[model samples]
Target chain A: MPVISYIDAVTQALQEEMQRDEKVFVLGEDVGVRGGVFRATDGLYKEFGAERVIDTPLTESAIAGVAIGASVYGMRPVAEMQFADFIMPAYNQIVSEAAKMRYRSNNTWYCPLVIRAPYGGGVHGALYHSQSVEKLFAGVPGLKIVMPSTPYDVKGLLKSAIRDEDPVLFLEHKRCYRLIKGEVPTEDYTVPIGEAEVKREGDDVTVISYGLTLHFALKAAEELEKEGISVHVLDLRTIIPLDKEAILEATVKTGKVLIVHEDNLTGGFGGEVSALISENAFFELDAPIRRLAGPDVPAMPYSPPLEKEFMLNPEKVKTAIRELAEF
Target chain B: MGSEESVMETSRHEALGLSDDQVLEMYRTMLLARKIDERMWLLNRAGKIPFVISCQGQEATQVGAAFALDREKDWLCPYYRDLGMMLVFGQTAKDQMLSAFARAEEPNSAGRQMPGHYGDKRFRVISGSSPVTTQLLHAVGVALAGKMEKKDFVSLTSFGEGSSNQGDFHEGLNFAGVHNLPVIFMCENNKYAISVPIEKQLAGGSVAARGQGYGMPGISVDGNDPLEVYEAVRDAAARARKGEGPTLIEATAYRLVPHSSDDDDRTYREMGEVEEARKKDSLVQFKKYLEDVGILSTESGAELEREIGHIVDEATEYAEQAPYPDPSETYTHVYAE
Candidate 1:
């Protein structure tokens, strides 16, 4: 095992996948000789020719549409959107074409493509660069949405996403790319799409989180353990087909639930997860499901204090968990 | 004669083929397309079909360009009013009728889409959208993939002249030019985008002029002449195969009908202009040119029309008898996984 940053894990996964399958190619702005804005695709163009690691024009819609067309014609394309915020321009291609191709064509077609976009806050990237819009795609049927918080999971989940027989929105948290470094296996492995990993198990309360906020929940769980209030932390790697068993079982064991995410609180993906628990295991809950999320503001800001104030952290997660555990 | 005059004459007669049979075949397909529209119009009026955008006057341009394409390999992204092109590209009259009637057996959409939304992935006809210029980029995308894969396939995208005003038109062509992709952007300059006439929508006065900015060759053709459209597309396809990048082709044609079955044309255009455009009807021009070239005998033209009308009638019978898609199908094909 080698220690790798989350961004390097993404590059490694792409490089390995390209080497393993000749049909896999990467295209995005600055992905070729320039090696991507975040260096997630560094050395790919040099290792494989420019054809395999392509740098496309600035048009996000073209990049998405080209990937879709190529995927339909026997090639797996991984398109990067520089930042998740820029993906709005290509939303039509994602929502209309990629999401509907399987159903509209009556299972005769599949968009075996991956759209990799770095999202979320904490890097002072201001408004346009930091957004967690994975919630927007959670309800889309054909698209599998993945948000990995650690280097190891990013590598494994990315491989699974590329090999999956459907279109996937592989959203990487830009803020966690370099901040989180961990040991990742060099061998090819796949983290199942809809499974949740228990980062830290306890009996006091169950804390469910994903993407960048998973770290905060875990930290909160560890800190709360010192206060004798043990927290069971669940990291939902894939948001679309959520691991219902893990959620139900965790809520039943702890009898309390607290959902955390980096996206804004209202209409975030946490609402769906909370709703699922309420519908499935309502009587098991000792208290109402609590959700601690980023302030309902328009993403992150450049000002340090404003950015920090709007961001979800371990303190907020701990406070929410403490309140829930007492119930 | 001056060089420009000779060139114009040659360009105008570009439709003139070496033999009579070629002209007759072109005229036959145009006749087939015309009859299909006639049948579709009748169906809508009789309440058998919901709506139709009759490709009455623009048959020559659609048929000619489709004939120039390699139906087996080349891809086509046709707009809603391209029933004529759809027929030429192997879309059976039965399949068209099934789609027009919103039946399950329609291969284009399997009853998932409205009529004229042509989409068959197996045939390389990328699904079309109602958005005017969106399909232009999809064409460029297919062309880009074709170039990258080193495949011997060219993508032909057909859109109205008004689509040139869209950013997608500019972006698609610019990308194709920048990458030297094998694509042909065919602008069916039907003189209007609904009520907005050419002058009101376009400041450059001609759609072909927009192509000059992209560094690709641009050609203006008499869209009413099937031979000219065929020659222009053939030349453009050859250029694409030779790695000469994309070409912007403006087919100057006329729209003799309203925008769609739901539209009223009297609100938009002057009756005089509509009358003037009717004189340049593509079918009429092709028929007259066939007669002038001795390709169309009076009996042969009537015989072709009768045969096409029978085919349309048989297809309508089949479509009318075919059942609508089961309601359960609505939830089935939304996703493969």
Candidate 2:
């Protein structure tokens, strides 16, 4: 086992996949030569050269369309949108073209495409930089939404998404890029696309979260461990085609469920998780299902205080779980 | 009575060394496309089909472009109204009917998408959807792959004058130009996008003029003349194979019928205008060329017409009788099984 940062793990997966399969290539603005704006694709251009590591123009739709085209023509394309918010211009291609390709073609054509974007708040990255597009993309069928909280999950899931027969949206929390580090094996491995992991196991209350919020939930569970209360932190690694069975299992075990996310509460992934739990495992729940999410606003603001208010702190998660238990 | 000389064809299709038989084959494909489009409309009226987007007056432009490409090696990303190009690219009359009928046997989509959304992998026809110009981007991407792999294949994508106004079209052509990819962008400027004419759609007044900005050679041809279109696309395909770059071709044709069976052309344009355009119909022009070349006669033309009608009849019957896809199949392809 080796400790690597979340960004490093993504780089490793891309490097390994490209080395193993020549068909796999990367294309986006500032990806080649620049090694990506965040250096997520560092050293790839040097290792693979300009041909495989293509530098595209500033057209997001073309970038996505090229990926769809290349994917259909026996090539695996990993396209990058500089930021999650900027992906709006390319959404028509991803959701309309790439997502519906297989179904529209009766499975005669498949787009083995992966669109990677850095999402979520907490780094004080204003409106354009700190948005989470997973909730927007999760509504689209034929697309897998993979949001990893740790380096190990990022490495494993990025590799799996590359080899998937269909399209996938790989969202990496920008705050977790260099902050989160974990042990990843040197041997070949993959994290299955539609599975969830319980980061910390407990009995009293189950807190379901993903991306950076999962870490908050884990910290809350740890702080509560010092007390007599036990809390289970369920990390939903893949949001779309959500690990329903894992959610039901956590519901059955804890009986007190709390779903949390950094996205606004109105139509967040937490809403879907809560709906599933209430629909499938309602009788098993001891109390009403709870959610701790960002308030309904346009986006994460630039001011630190406003941003902090928008984000769910570990202490807040702790308080929410305590209230759930009291109920 | 000494000797009667039939009007010799001085057309470019003949000058390009296409024998009368080859030219007649082109005519046959164009005729097949027109007949299939006509039949689909009939079905829509009879309540057997739901929609129809016709390639009525653009046969010469589409068939001629497909004729110039390497049928086995080159790829096509045809728009919704590309029945002529599909027929030339090996999509059969039955294939079009299956799609129109939206049955289980439909090769492109198994009763999932609407009619005119065409795609078949075997013919190298890239799948297309209803979004105006998305296929243009896909064609460029496929060409970029071929360029990277050093393949001899060229990708030809077609769209309307209206679609050329889409951002996808600009992005695709610009990207193709930057990379010097093996792509041929064919704009079938059919005078109208639904009801809006070219005057309202284009500011430059010429679609080909925009090609200079993308650094590719752009040419406009008479869509009513198949030979002129064949020459233009043939040259573009050659340039693509030589790795020179992409070429933009504006093939101006008329939309003989309404946009679809659902549209009422009388509300926007007069029947007098359609009748005026019908005199320059490519189908009639190409048939005259075949007759003048001494390869076809009144009797042979009528015979081919009968043969085409029978094929359409059989395809319609088979497709109409075919079953709709199972209800469970709706969820199957949404993700990998």
Candidate 3:
């Protein structure tokens, strides 16, 4: 087993998928010669050449729209959005075109597209670069939103997304790109798209989170264990087509739940999770379901103190966990 | 010289390499599109169908451009007003009626989308949406795939002059020109987009001339003449097949009817203007051409109209009697099963 960073896991998945299937190609700004801004597609351009690793002009809609067209033509295309914040220009393409391709065509056509966008807060990337854009697309039916927290999950889920028959929005937490490291096997294996993983098992409280915040929950769970508080941590690997069974089991096990995310709290994905838990496992609750997330401000500010106030760290997760457990 | 010019004008289709039968077929297709569109308007007025977007005056442009491409290999990403193109690409009158009726057998969307949202895998037509210019990028993507797979197929997409101002139109054409992809961007300049006239819609006053900015040749032709449109598209397809890249074509015509069934033209434009444009209708002009070429006599023209009338009548009856999709089917095809 070889330990790799989350970004390395991404590069490995692209390399393996492109090698295994000739139909799989990569396209986005600077994805070719420059290898991508984060270098997530590093060295893929040199190996696959320009035809497969296309460096497109700086137009998000075209990147998404063109990939959709090629996907309908029976090619698997992985399009990069440069940053998740820039994905708004391609919003219509994703929602109206790619998402509705199968339904509108009545199964006569489908878009096998993977739109990889680096998203999250915590870096000094201010308003434009650092943002959680998952909630914007979570409500869309035909799209599969996957945000992996670990290097292993990143590799497996990306491979699975590429092989999936429909459109998948693979969001990579930019902070976790190099920060998270884990062992990834070289063999071809996939972490199924719509499954949740219980990273730790305990009975006192349950913490549900994903992406970089999932790591925070795990760390908080470990620290809480020494304080005689047993916390169960569940990583929601896929947001849409949520693991209802896992969510119910995790919620029922501890009866106290705290959903954590870096996105704004008002209309975040946490609302959906809270609804699911309340609707299904309300009777089993020992305490009111609590949510720990960023404030409902428009975005993360540029100042470090303000940014820290908006970001969720391990200490915050630990406090949220302890408060729910004591209640 | 005057006699020589008259001789050339009489045999224009022959000079363009169109055999007598092919020109006759073009005339038939144009007439079929007109009759079907007219029937849809009547159905809409009768409260049978919900909406109708016509291809009334632009039939010549659609049929001509469609005939230039290899129907079996090339892909079409057409906009709403492309009934004529759909006909030439293998979509039958029944297919159009099924869509108009929003029936379960509708090949375009199975009653999911409204009529005029054309798409069918069997015809190699890429599905389109209500957005103005999104299909341009889709066509470019299809051409990109053709180039990548070493296939010699070209992709053609059409839109209104109003759509040329859309960012997608710029983005699609720029991408296609940059890669030298085998795609054709055809702009059916129908003088108005909904209610906005071309002068208000286009800043430069010409959609075809904008092609130079994207490194492609832009050509404008008479939209009422099928032979002219055919010649332009044929040359453009040849350029695309030779890997010479895309071409921008502007077929100038008038929208003889209002934008849709819901729109009332009297409020926006005068009847005199529409009646003037109707005089240059492609069906009338093309029939005279066929008559001059000694192909279609007055009796034959009447016979052709009767033949098309029967097809439209049969299609309408079949679609009207077709079943609606089961409610359970609404959940299917959102994703792969």
Candidate 4:
């Protein structure tokens, strides 16, 4: 076991994949010489040549379209958008071309590619730098979505996404890129996509979260433990083929559910989870499902207090859990 | 005709490398395309197919350009009105009929899309999107891949004069120019974006001029002249194989038919305007050239016409007899796995 940060795990996955497959290559803005703005691809360009680790122009649509074309012609391309917000220009390619390639072609062509982008807020990154585009992309079929909050999961999921037969949106929370560290394996390993991990199991209530919000759920579970409220924490690593069974099973046992995420409370992934439980596992529930999420605004200000106020902190999760416990 | 025919005159003899047999073949295919347009119009009138875009006057441009490429090796990403090109290529008449009928056996779209949205992965022909210039970017991508893989394949992508105004078109040309990708961008300038003519939609004098800023060769060709278009595309494809960059070619053709079966040209333009276009018909010009060279007689042209009419009729019967797939077939081709 080796202690590694989330960014290092991403780099490890890229290095290993590129070494394993000759078709595997990286292309993005500032990814070749600069090694990415967040240092997620540091030391990769030096190891690989300019052909494999390419620095493209500031055109996200070209990056996405080229990745798809290369993938169609028997190459595994891993494209990167500097920020999730900048992916808007490439959304047409992602949704129209990449997502529909397999379906429209009747699966004769599959876009085996990965698009990596740093998402979420709380890092003083202005409005344009932070966003959660998973929901927007989730509506598209033939695409997988991955959001890992820890170093080990990042390495495993990134590797899995690269080898996937379909396109994947690999979102690395910019807030958790350096803050989270875990013991990641040096040997090759891949955590399966579309599976949820039970970070902390408890019998009282379940707290479902993903990405940066998973840390807050765990912290809230710790705080609630002092108040004699045991909380089960589940980390939804992938969002598209979301672990609906795990969610229903966990909510059935705990009898109370609380979904947390960094995205806005309105029309968040939490709503999908809450709707699933309410639809399928309503008979087993002991209390109403609740969602603790960020404020319904574009993004928060850079000031410490404003950022703190905008984020779903541990205390808020604890309060929500206590209130649900009384129900 | 000797080599001194650059002034665009009607010559007695046929051009070199263009036999009367080839000219008749092109004419028959164009006639078939016109017939398909007429059938689609009748179908729309009788409440069958929702829409139909006719490629009547620009048949020479499509057929001649398609004749330049090897269908098995090269790729084509054609816009909506390229039935003539598809016929000239290896796409079977039954394939076109099935697509037009929107049947499960439709080799192009499989009932998932409309009639004109053609695509065949085996032939390396990608489906055209409804969006105007986005497919131009896709064409660049395909060409870039071909170049990177060292494949001797040239990608030919077609669009309308209206699509040239899109930003994606400029971006695609810019990328192709910078990377020197193997792509031939053909602009089928039919003079009208539905109702608004070229003068209102386009700002530049000619669409080919935009390629000059991207450091690529931009040339204007006589769309009605089949030999001229064939020569231009042949040269472009050869240059692409030699690692030269993209070329923008604007073929100023006419929309002899109404914009679509739904549109009525009587409201916007005069009948004299269409009669003027019919005067410069490619079929009549090529036929006279072939007759002058002794390669074609009036009887031979009539016989060829009768043969193509029989083929189109047989293809229609085959499509009509080919049973429409059951509803359950809808879920079959959605995913391979």
Q: Which candidate is the best by TM-score?
A: 3
* Steric clash pairs (candidate 2): none
B70-151 in candidate 3: lDDT tens per residue? 9889999999999999999999999999999999999999999988999999989989999889999999999999999999
Weakest ten-residue segment in model 3 chain A by summed lDDT:
A293-302
lDDT (10s digit) by residue, model 2, range A1-327: 889999999999999999999999999999999999989999999999998999998999999999999999989999999899899989899989999998888888989989999988888798889998888988999899999999999999999999999999999999999989999999889999999998888999999999998998888888898987899888999998799999999999999999998888888888888889889999999999998988899999999999988888899999999999889
Which residue pairs show backbone clashes in model 4? none
Could you tell me the lDDT of residue A124 within candidate 4?
82
Interface RMSD values, listed in order for every candidate: 2.1, 0.8, 0.6, 2.2
> Alpha-carbon error at A299 in model 4, in Å?
3.4
Which regions of candidate 2 are displaced past 4 Å?
B1-11
- In Å, residue B249's CA in model 4 sits off its true spot by 1.6
TM-scores of the models, in the given order? 0.95, 0.98, 0.99, 0.94
- Candidate maximizing lDDT: 3
List the candidate numbers ranked by DockQ, top first.
3, 2, 1, 4
| lDDT tens digits by residue: candidate 1, A1-327 | 799899999999999999999889999999999999999999999999788888887888878877887787678899999999999988888888888777766676667899999999888888888888987888888788998889989999999999988899999999888899999987889898878888888998998988889999888888888899999988899887789999998898898999998888899988999999999999999999998887887778989999888888899888999999877
lDDT of each: 0.85, 0.91, 0.94, 0.82
True-structure lDDT of candidate 4: 0.82
In candidate 4 chain B, where is summed lDDT lowest over 10 consecutive residues? B7-16
Supply candidate 3's per-residue lDDT for A203.
Answer: 96
